[model samples]
Target chain A: MGHGGGGALSGELTRHLFTPAYGNETLGGLGDSAVLPLPGARLAFSTDSFVVRPLFFPGGSIGDLAVNGTVNDLAMSGARAAYLSCAFILEEGVGLPVVGRIADAIGAAAAAAGVVIATGDTKVVEAGHGDGVYVNTSGIGLVPDGVDIRPQRAVPGDVVIVSGPIGLHGIAIMSVREGLEFGVEVESDTAPLGSLVEAMLAVTRDVHVLRDPTRGGLGTALNEIAAASGTGVALVERHVPVPEAVAGACGFLGLDPLYVANEGRLVAFVPRTEADAVLAAMRAHPLGTGAAVIGECVAEHPGMVVSRTGLGGTRVIDLPLGEQLPRIC
Target chain B: MGHGGGGALSGELTRHLFTPAYGNETLGGLGDSAVLPLPGARLAFSTDSFVVRPLFFPGGSIGDLAVNGTVNDLAMSGARAAYLSCAFILEEGVGLPVVGRIADAIGAAAAAAGVVIATGDTKVVEAGHGDGVYVNTSGIGLVPDGVDIRPQRAVPGDVVIVSGPIGLHGIAIMSVREGLEFGVEVESDTAPLGSLVEAMLAVTRDVHVLRDPTRGGLGTALNEIAAASGTGVALVERHVPVPEAVAGACGFLGLDPLYVANEGRLVAFVPRTEADAVLAAMRAHPLGTGAAVIGECVAEHPGMVVSRTGLGGTRVIDLPLGEQLPRIC
Candidate 1:
């Protein structure tokens, strides 16, 4: 189970298992998406499978996540998603209406994202051999010329900015799973971030690195960037955004807001000179209204992420060994 | 389970469930793979998920099926596969070595097919929630400029030819699954068909249709083409190739060889004038040595497939309502 947690175990599986087996340069880069140079265009490709426990969540369902997750992966590479291929693994006894609802949600999500479901496949497993349904979506996007974004491009003097509040999506799923709730309901912030990324790129194409803080949240995403680029990340803990409902829920649940998963948010590492312009452009978009600068890339303590606490002490934020919440996305 | 049977139930699901939900031109076409016109090239994209039981089979495993299935789909579009993205949904508690062997198979299969595994993803489901593993592969291929192959292009004057033997894959899996044995062990005819398709195209780009008779075998594939092209098919029952072991197994199992599944064979609809040349080209390829012309498209009885019996009688071959063997792919 830890191998799917998107943490240290997941990283090890890719390094020791997948990379050794695959032995390819494109996959060796370990980016959020693989960019292939075609005849006249460079295309970004990515894939993700959603096995969340509950079929439907507070603000979203697995259907929407299937679309947005891959779309966000392509956006991280500075690409506008153009087409998606969807495949479903359905349990035998599941009702047709349930499958219908999920398909409807997928249709709506693709429409909202301005992408087409170009191809699809479906398979059924005998009951008890599968959850109700599992959806896998793979996307292809066009990378505009002169725009380059990758984890390895992060360098010293880069400013780190997050699109919005964290921990809501993780806490939202947990609240329903465990039947616990704060005074205000926390909804999964699942939405397409392609336009938000395009807005930032419009300001400048010099964005060094862009990653969506998904399974292991903002803290783990920063750690990955630091390691991939061989630079250090210095964070101001107080500047990180956490909604009151999410914070209250995490407090009772004994969870850290920084390590919770988010579906709709992204962490961008831009050159210090372009940081202000990028932040302003992000704020101008509807999905990035809560955007804030939370950290900076530093030359000290390369490959590590250290945070300055509100209590005037510093602590290292390590990659999580396993998931605190499994199957949240 | 019948919904995944590649028969009548599967067609209804696609027509009433998927088509209404998706409501797009490319998806409505319902080709084995979708051909998208990009800036400088037309690309073919396809996706498939492998949930075959007993991960390891006689001649191939789910790993090779995951690669070859999607690759064959792209090949049916007259495109040589360029790249594939693989995703795995693993059940908790499966051994690492098992995953390693499967990954090695995928790597070797991709290398043999002349395609690259460009990107991948993995997710783990808790024990009892899934089978040992389910693999999903999505592929992208570049379509040649002057070659156009699709189901609806099968004209009445087209001649039908099959690449090789049928019923071997389905019977091989059944022999292992049910603990039944014939005098000689039957092996799955699982092999990549991209090179064979290219060879036939070299003979004639005027080939109208090409489909890998996978799940529902030759009987169902011809029905689909007949329905799609609004034509009738006349098959000579004696001319369709079936190996001795496969024929013996199907006879004892009370199954018709026409409806049994095949992995490596293809059914092509070529113009009557070019059929001889294409058949010659197919016979020259390693994978198509057993190729034979079995039938022809007809103007009588549109949208149906009728076969001439070995007894000199004629009968309609209906699309199967449900799977005779489940999860054979």
Candidate 2:
């Protein structure tokens, strides 16, 4: 189950099974999205499977996660999602009302994201053969002209900005999973980021790296970008936002907030000169209201991440072997 | 279970759950594939989930089935498959060897079909939360110019042709499911139809309907076409090809081969004038070596299917309420 951890195990599995088998140009990115140049348009294609244990969560349900997740994936590639394909695997005993609720969520999420569900498939397995419902959503988005965003584009002088607070999504799901509710609810920050990404692109086409810290949380996402770009990431730990309720819950569960998952947050790498404008643009969006510049790419210790501790000591932030939570996405 | 039957229950579920939720122009076709018109190309998009009980089957495994299944869906739209996105939901504890074998098969099948696995995602659920592995593949194919194929395009006087002998896939799976052996082993007929469809298109662009009889077999596929097109179908029962091995296995299990699944076979509806040329083209392909004309669209009893028995009697082959075998695909 840790394969969903989005950490070492997931990387190992992909490298072991998929990389060698389907080694080709478009699939070579191994990024959040695969960018392809179609005849008349450059498009981004990506797929995500939602197996979140709880059908419903504090802020949203799997429905919102499924749609927003894929849309955000395309957004990470600087694409505006236009069409999506939804595939559902439902268990036999799941009720019609539950299905209806999920459908409504998907429809609403797509509508909110300004994307259409162009195609879809539904398959029902015998009871016990599957969980209540598992959804696989694949999307195609149009990559705007002049915008080239990828982890490989990150460089030494790049500034890292997170769209908003992290660790909320994982804590939200964990709260429901463990049936423990904090006094102040920690809801999953599940929302579409097409507009947020568009806002950033409006400011500058020089955006280098864009990634949603999903299954493996912020730590794993940063580690991946660092490893992929062969650059070091130095973080001002205090600048990374964390809500009080989320922090309290993580501390209670003995979990690192950095390794906890998030659904709607994104980490962006941009040139230092343009980072201010991009940060302002991100901050203007509703989804990016808490946007903050938290780190910068460094020349030393390439492919590693170091964060300044409150006591002035540097701590190596390693990618967890596997996420503390599974199916958080 | 039966919801994936591709029969009455399947249609009912789609009508009740999926149809209303995803009622867009392209999705409403509810064809084997959704036909999409991109900026510079008309494309066919389709998705299928493979949850066959035993991952490894006799002639082929779920790997081959996943690739060929999506490719065939695109081919049904008279399209040349170009790219596919694969998403896997694996159960924890599945051996690496199994995953490796499946990936190898997927790569081989995609290479053989002349399509590329463009992008993919993998997620693992906890042990027992899933069967060994379930694959959901979504594909996009280019619909050639002057080609328009759909079930609703079928009309009276259209000729119906089967690409090859049917029921091989279903029986192959059943043989493994029951652990029963017939003197002769039945192999799965799973194969990509991209080149085969191209061959038919080369002959004429007037192919009205092209459908792969996977679940619920030929009877259900024709019944669906009849109901969708508001036309009656009359078949020559004796002309329907049934392999000796599959027929024997079905006989032993007291199953109707007409309702058995076939992964590689397709039934085409063509105009009477061009049927001979199209048939000749299909017969020239190795995958269509066993092609035969077994039926025709008719004027009587619209939205129904009637077959002529060897005794000069007519048999109404109603679509089965659901498939006899679950997860056969």
Q: Considering every candidate listed, which one attains the maximal DockQ?
A: 1
- Cα interface RMSD of each candidate: 0.7, 1.4
* Shift of residue B272 alpha carbon in model 1, Å: 0.8
Give the residue spans of candidate 1 off by over 4 A.
none
| Candidate 1, pairs of clashing residues | none
State residue A195's C-alpha deviation in candidate 1, in Å.
0.7
Q: Candidate 1 chain A: worst 10 consecutive residues by lDDT?
A: A18-27
Candidate 1 per-residue lDDT, tens place, A1-329, comes to 99999999999998899888877888987888999988998999999999997989899999999999999999999999999999999999999999999998999999999988999988989988899999999999999989889999999999999999999889989999999869888899999999999999999999999999999999889999999999999999999999999889989999999999999999999999999999999999999999999999999999999999999999999999989899988
lDDT of 1 by residue, B162-233 (tens): 999898899989999998999898888888899999999998889899999888888999999999999999
Q: What's the C-alpha lDDT at position B152 in model 1?
A: 95
Assess every candidate by TM-score. 0.99, 0.98
Q: Please report how far candidate 2 places residue B289 from its true position, in Å.
A: 1.0
The C-alpha RMSD of each candidate to the native structure, in angstroms, is: 0.8, 1.2
lDDT scores of the candidates, listed in order: 0.93, 0.89
Error of 1 at A208 (Å): 1.1
Return the lDDT, model 2, position B117: 85
DockQ-based class of model 1:
high
